[model samples]
Target: MSENLWEHRPESGYVTGTDLAGYRVEAIDGHIGKVDKHTAEADGANIIVDTGVWIFGKEILLPAGCISAVDHPNGTVFLNRTKEDVKGAPEFHRDHHTEAPDYRLTLGDYYSGRVL
Candidate 1:
């Protein structure tokens, strides 16, 4: 697995507020989805993507660490990972793993291939 893209990095000026909802998310290869919601907490930030009809209506949460850039003008969130990487990630269960720190750890481990 690859390392967390934003590890040890401070929030870039491009990383705006939760107002990013509805912005299209672009993977390294191509478009993935739009931001359904976003949350910024003490630990980190995350974005809930709504892949409308792209993968049978699948929605996934991506850690802010995965973000490589934010193009507010274009209404897009660029990710460091490819679409395949995000597709193979552990499925997101609404309200089940959102608040679970252990679940997040597992997800972080899954992405970086290291215990977090």
Candidate 2:
């Protein structure tokens, strides 16, 4: 996985300290869901999307690197990934999704194209 996979790109329009909760998450294909939670840690930024009925309410974690842009004005976050990409990610485990290194690696690998 890439070293910067967890850091938002400079051009992604994500301002540090910005609260992304509730922002609509849009994949390359279409709307996926809303942001249930987010983190802005310098080395561990990411978003947890609540997929609602689209995937039986499954929540998926996406690395900041997948974000192509953040439209705060419209309350939407654009991702470079497709809907299938987000859908195929590991399911969010509320208990260990945040602090688990293995979980992060799995996510990073999935998003970085290292894992199929």
Question: Which one wins on TM-score?
Answer: 2
Identify the runs in model 1 with alpha carbons over 4 angstroms from their true place: 1-12, 16-18, 114-116
Give the alpha carbon lDDT tens digit for every residue of 66-115 in model 1: 87778778888888788888898888886897777777887786667522
Q: What TM-score does each of the candidates earn?
A: 0.83, 0.92
Q: Residue 57 deviation, candidate 1, in Å?
A: 0.5
Runs in model 2 deviating more than 4 A are 1-3, 114-116
Residue 113 accuracy (lDDT) in model 2: 81
The true-structure Cα RMSD of candidate 2 reads 2.2
CA-lDDT, candidates in order:
0.75, 0.87
Candidate 1: residue 47 lDDT (0-100)? 80
Q: Which residue window of length 10 is worst by lDDT in model 1? A: 1-10
Q: In candidate 1, which residue pairs get closer than 3 Å at backbone N, Cα or C atoms, i.e. clash?
A: none
Give the range of the ten consecutive residues with the poorest summed lDDT in model 2: 107-116
Please tell me which predicted candidate would have the highest lDDT against the true structure: 2
